[model samples]
Target: MGAFGRMRNSLSFTPPDLQEARLEPVRRRIVFYIPGYDPEARTRYRLLFVREWTRYTKRFGGGRREISRAELSQDGLVQSWTVSAPEQGDGAETRYDVLLWDDIVARDFARSRFLSVALLIVGTLQTILSGLLFRFYRLSWKYGNVILYPFVMVILLAALSVAIAALVHAHLGDWFGHSLGLPLWVSLPLGVIAGLVWIKAIEAFLNRVFFWQLLNDWVFNWQHGQGRRPDYERRLDAFAEHILSSVAARDEAGHSTDEVMIVGHSSGGLTAAEVAARVLARDTSIGTSGANLSLATLGSGLPLVAMQPAAARLRGEIARLVTDRRIVWCDFHAPQDWMNFPGFNPLHDLKLRLCGQPVANPLVRSARFRDLLCPETYRRVRFRPFRMHFQFLLANERPGAYDFFAMTLGPRRLREQVLAPDAYSEPEPAVPL
Candidate 1:
């Protein structure tokens, strides 16, 4: 029989004795450090033991595998493991055990609660940037006979971006649906043109839309303080300094250390990169001496930065500032993600080029966040290499999320054995353009 034929022969509605995949317990001992001096951050890290243990256990299966033990000291440890399950019907049960550790990842979770909440709110707001920038109609108004109206820049660009995004996403899938049965001339340029137009429209709105109060506050806080934060680069520059100084303090006395890794998700990516850049410029030690300052952007919404009311000088600084050549700037993108860059979202790539190119900073994209929630099966979806954009940052908390995190972000701090490459994916391996 042919390859397709053999697969159909072994079918039965009832459960069979096929070899079931064993659910193994995960173990690791590692030190997780975050840059800062916030008492709040330390508090939040402490709270993580309570939240992560509860969430992961429920998110996956029942609380059979997870085991948690507490410590008397202020700093505690959290250990987790998944127990085996019986194969029955079409589904199975898995247990997780989290054992308390002498240490924790990050810091006081509640202390940085403001930071996390701010980032989440920013994530929600950025979704509306493109939609809010355009005008449906600026036509002249007329009650009796006097009527006048002009298309403003924000409205025009916002509308264009939406229209372009709709058209490309709606049509390109069909055109490329076939195996290039026709020549590439027709569809490739069409896709690029459509994508470019949308990017330009979004960029225009961001560049001119006048900074919204909420955005400025978040940016300000990320740089220094939150919501009350104003639109100033100095605030962010200070923030960069704070994180760097904290990192320096944490470094062991004998070992010479230089850089701090800024790991950001979605909107956090944009804010971190820009703020870090400004910080580096203010102090040569942060940028010039060692390859210390690094950026790891996940599910980026950096284009949101353009939506602010930036000054000519600020724009000039962003447009021309150079990054240390050795700084590692890694980006994770997922093709299956609706909000992820380079798919339905084109703004991310543009922001990177406009900001990253100036400094010759190395830019790399990897595959991530592809598997979606499987509705039909009880088991969560599997991760596809090059596909998990949204969940890459959250992988630390998801099923098999460990393998991906360990390799990309884990090896440095998260100690887990044999992180599987197929568990998730990396992008086209950073090819220079």
Candidate 2:
């Protein structure tokens, strides 16, 4: 069998072997999950998680994994779900409280078209400059491709813009002036407006293919406040308070708190890291006192922003996260996902000159899509890199080393599963399957 064949076979479903995982005492759990640059309502994510969990239960639930319908909060920013199953030959219920931070991303999508276009121009230039510098640094061959693809796409867009302008002037100029009997001054401005409209339309079409909105947002935030948005800060504060409250409730009830895992996907990776850093900032003994705090950043785009020289504030936050021994940070990267910088290390890649002592904490691991999907499903979506990026949050087609639902809702704690001896590694891409 080839590598792909082996990967598929390895992921084939087997009866649930509860013995493979070390059983932990039943305790309350909390997860603060942040989605990518998405503008969809929180209900969308709620349904998505429900659907994925349902699929997981059908596949490997072994008629044991039972999940409750996700109950949305009145404010609609938080959702809570409960999962129960027999573990270690004992029946115990695990309460999974998930808080989704999504307001800022929706606000980003609601920006005026005029402002979006203006920011696009500025962001495009910034992206080109950053790409060139990344290539100059010789980070990786993949980095070169990342730089080349966007630069080439932008050039193509520019060429298309020029072509549309020329076509408008050629076909419409004479007709407007003579047949419509419009003066040259009036005709010229109309033609220009028509050309600009065509360009904007084409830009919108290209965005579906290249995801320019994410790039534009990243650049805008980096240049503006280095990924610091007031709404995001407010939400982060709320999340921290929720964590403390959950821990407090467990304490008052005389139950031990299991774990608090902050999961960030795509751009949410950056947000998750910063939020965890802030929580530590406010209370340095948070993880040490009660529940173990952990961070799982899946398909994170941290390098996209951190690579830029203007991302000083973000870098500072990252450096703080690195040295904080209380938090367990596990960064999962997939080589197949072009949306994230696979195998990139933020501290070394950004070349941070930190003011405080630096420590290596984030153990980079590979979330291989090949191992997660069936052969047919993997082959079908392998070429659709963007969809593959989202596979991080969805249920695995077949269980293997890493399962998102299992991490969040399974019997074992995040720290127990991820902090195992072979569960961590330095920043490096997993070998392609």
Candidate 3:
């Protein structure tokens, strides 16, 4: 009991303000999931969703969580599946479309070692020189460390490798020359060989810890922010078109869809925001097309690129989305996740309202991971940065105000959760007849 109290006290965070409002329950929903900078294909996420959704059902014990077999689109741009819960509310069905861009991420991660390191250096300099790193520190010190991690790790590793090479050259030089009767000059090459071996070992260790993967992510962000990646822009356009088509489609019963939710996690949050803005640009009346349109960005790294001076295009998109107020936007952040910015109101934080028209958006809300997970579970994952970051997309150990499965698959609309989480997250107590 004491441990639990300490856990709660330690992990608690104040959530942003959202007005109370009653929203209609959803009968049919469409979810477009944009993943972060991961090289894995959509199939991996499908399996994870299946696994976690099953766990969610067991934990909450509502009913069977029936998910259809995933189907890949002919164009191979998306993989989709259906989820149904017959006993929840009025019976809800959700179609999930997993947007595919992992191939691009894989290509980024597959670059030559020399090229990758060079890009990392370039990215680090840009981030620091642009004053974005200091701005990040001012916004959230922990998150600033996230941005600094790759560069710091690289420097530390290089120093260690050089020290190892020097030590080998100094101490082992005489011994090797005497043992093999080789010239003392051969020790220099041996030391160089030792340094190379150390570097290889360090590379293996970095791969195991996802350090290189994250470094590549930073490089990708820098490139994408500078508008150097035309591939991303093209993909964003395609994603926008796909969303527009999905929202326009009618169900098998010839009835319009109830709600369309675009969910972006981690770096995908930037992509999701751009996609939403693009959809709005193509069709100004997308929000008023009788379908409830909402965007949910969870543990997003949008600020990483959006905060840069070279990211005016992204800022414009964000401003468009923020000032419009037509589509509902909610950003779910966790204080514990160093990878995301919590308590970030895009309008005020980015001064987007000042950039364009004034309007409040992206009702920033904390995921309250501690409240949702058990004390033991929370303790185990508290220090694991990646796990805590990914927790936004995973199932909670205990039901709470934030449940990814509940928000996406349950009968409630995402708008309701954004507006009045306290009111809509759980059912009210029974009254006497």
CA lDDT, every model vs. true structure: 0.36, 0.64, 0.77
List model 3 lDDT by residue over 129-189, tens digit each: 8777877776667777877888888888778878887777776566644444445688778
Deviation of model 3 at 69, angstroms: 0.8
**In candidate 2, which residue pairs clash?**
none
Residue 416 lDDT in model 2?
Answer: 54
With candidate 1 superimposed using the best TM-score fit, by how many Å does residue 223's alpha carbon deviate from the native? Answer: 15
Question: What is the Cα root-mean-square deviation between model 1 and the actual structure?
Answer: 21.4
lDDT of 1 by residue, 297-400 (tens): 56554433443333223344444333344344444544343333432122222232354343443243434333323333213434321123335434233233
If both were scored by TM-score, which would come out higher, candidate 1 or candidate 3?
A: 3
Q: Compare candidates 1 and 2 on TM-score and give the better one.
A: 2
The parts of candidate 2 lying over 4 Å away from their true place are 1-26, 86-98, 130-162, 175-182, 199-212, 224-228, 352-360, 419-433
Which one wins by lDDT: 2 or 3? 3
Model 2, range 303-344, lDDT digits (tens) per residue? 666666676777878887776667778788776776665556
Which candidate's lDDT is highest?
3
- lDDT value for model 2: 0.64
Q: How well does candidate 3 score on lDDT at residue 186?
A: 83
**Which ten residues in a row are the worst by lDDT in model 3?**
3-12
User: For every model shown, what is its TM-score relative to the native structure?
Assistant: 0.39, 0.79, 0.88
What shift in Å separates residue 90 of candidate 2 from its native position after superposition? Answer: 7.8
